[model samples]
Target: MALSEITTRLTAAAQAHGRDASGITLIAVSKVQPAERVEAVLTEGHRVFGENRVQEAQGRWPAFQEQFGGIDLHLIGPLQSNKVRQAVEMFSAIHTVDRPKLAKKLADLAQERGTCPDLFIQVNTGEEPQKAGCLPSEADGFISDALAMDLPIKGLMCIPPIEEEPTLHFALLAKIARRNGLEGLSMGMSSDFEKAIAQGATHIRVGSAIFGERVPG
Candidate 1:
């Protein structure tokens, strides 16, 4: 689908929930996509983008940002401690911060480098053993620890189990954010973004619906 079509649908979805569309950020998940496809979206004037890998973004975004100013890049994947500095420098937001060690690393880097992207603690709302997030039960303590360390945490993010109803997970994430005094909820994807919006998602990551299927390597 075209970017306009996606935006229209997103706006309608927000309106349907009695929420203002302008308050919702649409992050185009550009992971694994070629730079040409990214450029095409940039050409369409969509500025916010989500990338899952630091290396892939480092390989392409420097030039893309040089050519197309005002773009916001979000790192929406698991981050390693070793890459904290680079991720802090490159992304406008880091949405998968799920542990104390990584959160402390980001805080130290922010102090040293004087740049800190918005942070979102990823919660494994469904308690999936394989997922990259803190368990739902640990979210409050983790958010407190991040705040004590001066990490610029702004919200909570979660990837619901594909087999479960996503609305339940989205609601859980929103609740976690609220209990911890967070305002941003980075839940939702191409499959059920409208439901996410209804559940108070401030940012929705959509990829395939707008860019089509990923080309298998």
Candidate 2:
């Protein structure tokens, strides 16, 4: 499908979910997509994007910024504790903060540099052992730990298991966010974004639907 058609579908889905299209931000996942495609979306006036790898985001963001002035880049995948400093520097927001070690590293980096990007704790909503998020039961403690630092804790994020119904996962994240006083829920993607919007997803990461299948890396 074309980019314009994708945008229209996204808008329609937002509307069908009883959500104002403006309320939710569609962060085009630009992981393996080339800069030209990203530029195409920018030409369509998409200012926010999500990327899975910090290195990938770092490599592409500079040119995108040069051309687009300042696009909002979100780190939407597992963030290694070792790369916290660079991750803190490159992206506008980090959505995969899953452990206290990484959190502390981000906090320390922020203290040294006097800045840290918006932070979102990634929760293992699906309890997938292979995933890179903290389990749901430990959310409050982790959020509290991150909050104690001077860095801003904006909200929570999760990637539900691909095979399951997303509403259950979205609802779980929403519940945790509410309990922790978090306002942002970065859930949903190409397939279940409307369901996400209905459940109060502030940020939706869309890839295949927006950019089409990625060019193989």
Candidate 3:
């Protein structure tokens, strides 16, 4: 589908859910997609995008930013402590902040830089061991710890197990966010975004639906 069609679908979903379409951020997931495809979406005036890796984004977005300003680049993948500085420099938001160690590192960097991108605590609602999120039980304590360091905790993010119902996870994420007074919910992806929108997703990541199948990076 083209960018417009995907956007139309996103808007329709939001409206169907009784949400104002403009309030929902449609994040174009550009990870592993070809540069031409990403540029094509940008050419269509899309400014918000998500990248799965810091290095890949560093290599891909700089030129795009130079050509098209006001791009909001989000780091939507696992983050390594060693790469935080570079990631902090390039991405506008980090959605996979799931541990105290990483949160402390980000807090330190934010203190030194006097500014940092908004953060979303990734929650492993499915409790999948291989996944990159804090467990559901750990979310409140984690949020407390991160906020104690003055980290800008925007909201909660989650990736439901591929085999399970996504709305259950979305509801879990929204519940965690609500109790913590978080307003942003960066949940949902290409397949289950409409469900996410219904559950109050503030940001939805869509990639292959906008750009065709990604070229492996």
Candidate 4:
């Protein structure tokens, strides 16, 4: 599907949920997609994009930025402590800051570089042990730790369990954001972004719906 079509879908989804489409930001998840494809989306007037890995984004972003100014990059995958510097360097916002250690590392790197990117605390709403985010119960503590750092704490993010209804997770995220006084909720994808919009998602990261399947690296 074309970029506009996906955006249209996202807009429609937002409206269906009685949301103001203008209030929600759609981040085209461009992980593993080439620079050419990213440029295509930029040409289509998409300023926000999400990537899962720091290295892959680092490899692709400079070229895209050269052609399109003001591109906002969101790191939508797990971040290692070592990659905190790279994540701080590349992403405009780091969406998967799940633990206190990674958050502190990012804060330290940002302090050294004098640029702290916006941060979203990742919440494993499903409480999955295999996932990267902090469980919902542990989220407040992590958020407390992150708030003490320099990174601008924007909000929360989560990937709901694939087998269950997403609304449950979305509601949980909303509750957490409300309790924490955070406004940004980065959730949803091609499959459930509409549901997310219905439940107050501020940012939706969509990949396959816009860019299609990953092109082999």
| Collision count for each candidate, in order | 0, 0, 0, 0
* Local accuracy of candidate 4 as per-residue lDDT tens digits, 1-217: 5778877877898888787889898899988887677778888888998988888888888977887889998899888887877788788888898887787787778778887888899999998889989999999988988887757899999999999999999999999999999999999998898889989999998888888888978
What TM-scores do the predictions have? 0.98, 0.93, 0.98, 0.94
* Candidate achieving higher TM-score, 1 or 4: 1
Q: Kindly indicate the candidate among 3 and 4 with the higher lDDT.
A: 3
For candidate 3, report its TM-score: 0.98
What lDDT does each candidate get? Answer: 0.92, 0.87, 0.93, 0.87
Q: On a 0 to 100 scale, what is the lDDT of residue 55 in model 2?
A: 84
CA lDDT for candidate 2:
0.87
Give the deviation of candidate 3 from the true structure as CA RMSD. Answer: 0.8
* Model 1 residue 102 CA deviation in Å: 0.2
Predicted model with the maximum lDDT:
3
Worst 10 residues of 1 by lDDT: 208-217
Candidate 4, residue 79: how far the Cα is off, in Å: 1.0
Residue 145 C-alpha lDDT in model 4: 82
Better of 1 and 2 by lDDT: 1
- What ranges in model 3 sit over 4 Å off? none
List model 3 lDDT by residue over 107-209, tens digit each: 9999999999999999999999899899999999999999999999999999999999999999999999999999999999889999999999999998888
Q: What are the C-alpha RMSDs, in order, of all predicted structures?
A: 0.9, 1.6, 0.8, 1.5
Evaluate model 1: give its TM-score: 0.98
